[model samples]
Target: MFIPFQPLRTSSLSKKAPTSVGRVVAITGGSGFIGGHLLDALIADDTVSRIYVMDIAPTTRWCEKVTFVYTNLARDVQFEPQQKIDVVYHLAAVSREPGFEWNEYFDINYEGTRRLLKWASKLDIKNIVFTSTGMVFKAGPFHRAPSEVPSADTAYGISKALAEEALSGWQQSKRGRHVAVVRPGAVFGRGCGGNFVNLHRALRLGTFAYIGGPDTVKSCIYVKDLVALMRGAAELKGWHVLHGTYPQAPTIGEICNAFCKVFGWTRVIPTVPLNLALRAAAPLQMLNELGFSNPVHKRRVEKLHYSTDIDGSGLLELNLAPTHSLVEAIQDWRDECAPADPH
Candidate 1:
């Protein structure tokens, strides 16, 4: 659990300064939540000359001067960066929530990643920052502290665990790659519309319900903080893993209470028996898998209990210094749903 989380060297302000204008970079899933935020951050840097946005979905708004490439990385498609790529942020994958078939998850999360990494190496790409999730550490001997144990709760965790292992192994050989692995916990931000977003909206509308008591802890990172970690990772070497999240580690009760505090509403949620929830969730989960919709069945009741403990010593070393507050991520979400400016 203890690792030297410091940067290999001191970073000067200049180094962190924008790369020369017109610097070209590649980002998969650029149209998605985290990806979109990173894209915006990159564009704000005066050093960035150009950004190559690639994803399965089209961007709502793309910079006129940037390059936009569309490709489904899940398939057997070959992808090559058209311009001189400065840094490659690998963020695209499946399993937006869960319930996909074993093969489908493998094809996208595992095989698709393998394809992208191999292509990058072949292209002599050196700077690669991968957006991995913290679930890789699930299935742990639960009840241990995040500071004490590493465990995850799903096959999604296993896929990422294996993927990181493979990537780190490559770095060991001094192969044609240097990687920075960013493992973020639950992420909420604008345009994410992820699993948590629905929950937030549901709770705000007074329709959301939970079986767990208020004390079920959850760890989450704001999308903006995740973007900062990705930028810092571009300057990393070998296999460096860091979690982009808050240290407070709020619980399920705390999350609901926070919503209540912000929205001025409260309702006692009825608890469904765990066994009943599990039995009923399987078929619903299967349906979600078939339709490619995120599954929030009975199994999720257990996920809320996952240890929110995450170490960020590695993040500190990179000087990424996440400045965004975790509450802000949710607050913005609430604002989006609350009301709009009259302008």
Candidate 2:
């Protein structure tokens, strides 16, 4: 059943907004992993009076405060008169590794963003918080500031960088409207999908093998912490372009060892050279190109070695420090979401 948006009072102390202040908010990709978490947060905020969720899919976890508006952002975005949105949280995109058509990335990431911004502009809806990615930067040991010009070597990064540009243009054309583009790291949590989820699953089963040296550092954030940053961004003014990542990231070996300790596993994890694994996974990756769902893709394997060191100092200036430690978040996910038996 479709229910109109309503704000309900809750006793939980709000870290960002004291109240949503009866704002009618809208979110694209509301049924998605990160979007879903943000939706829940909005529903809990008494300051928000209504929420319009525009997505192709439907959400099973419905509430009276949410109204799902079916939208194909790749084509066009339309909403009813009663659903006039005050603020927009654009989270819709095609964000997965392997097997994405070249046009699909542009169609969804670039065109979809353009279409949404145009539609929202027509509605005179100003406040926008777009969820971008840290992948826009080159893969290395370097930490980058949000003010620095972006360099995208991959199609995904290029599409997102273009989208950010479009949003920036829109912000310039208008007055008194703030645009926030948040580039987050590998976000992980219960029910979240990504390489981190796969890694945690393998670790839980004791079937995870070391792919490369332990010294490779990666920037990551808990989904809840990332969501908190998003909320903080929405409440702030001016262009909030910042990186949503851990202030202090842990190395791959350290993260893996933490899992072993949490799971009470004394067994020494086996390891393989990065080059050897990539060479072995090449044929499987070729099969993946032929429409096969190969788990071991060369690109996916390379992520094990790539250091995603993102500078999150910009967000600290916004007073949005990451609350949960990586170790604590991983343990919570394992205890709350892991299967009872993984043998």
Model 1 Cα shift for residue 222 (angstroms): 1.4
Instruction: Give the worst 10-residue stretch by lDDT in candidate 2.
Output: 11-20
Overall lDDT per candidate, in order of appearance: 0.65, 0.78
Root-mean-square deviation per candidate: 9.0, 5.9
Write down the TM-score for model 1: 0.79
How badly does each model clash, as a count of residue pairs?
Answer: 12, 5
Candidate 2 has what TM-score? 0.89
Q: Give stretches of model 2 more than 4 Å off.
A: 1-21, 81-83, 290-292, 338-343
Task: TM-score each candidate.
Answer: 0.79, 0.89
Question: Tens digits of per-residue lDDT for model 2 on 1-343?
Answer: 2233343344211222233448888888988888888887887888888777788887544675666677898787765536456788999998885558777878999999999988988888879999999988877767677787888777788899999999999988879888999999888876686677677678777777777777777778888888899888887776778788877667788888776777776656678898898898898888877978768887778888778877886666668978777778777767766574211
Collision pairs in model 2: 19-47, 20-47, 20-48, 21-47, 22-47
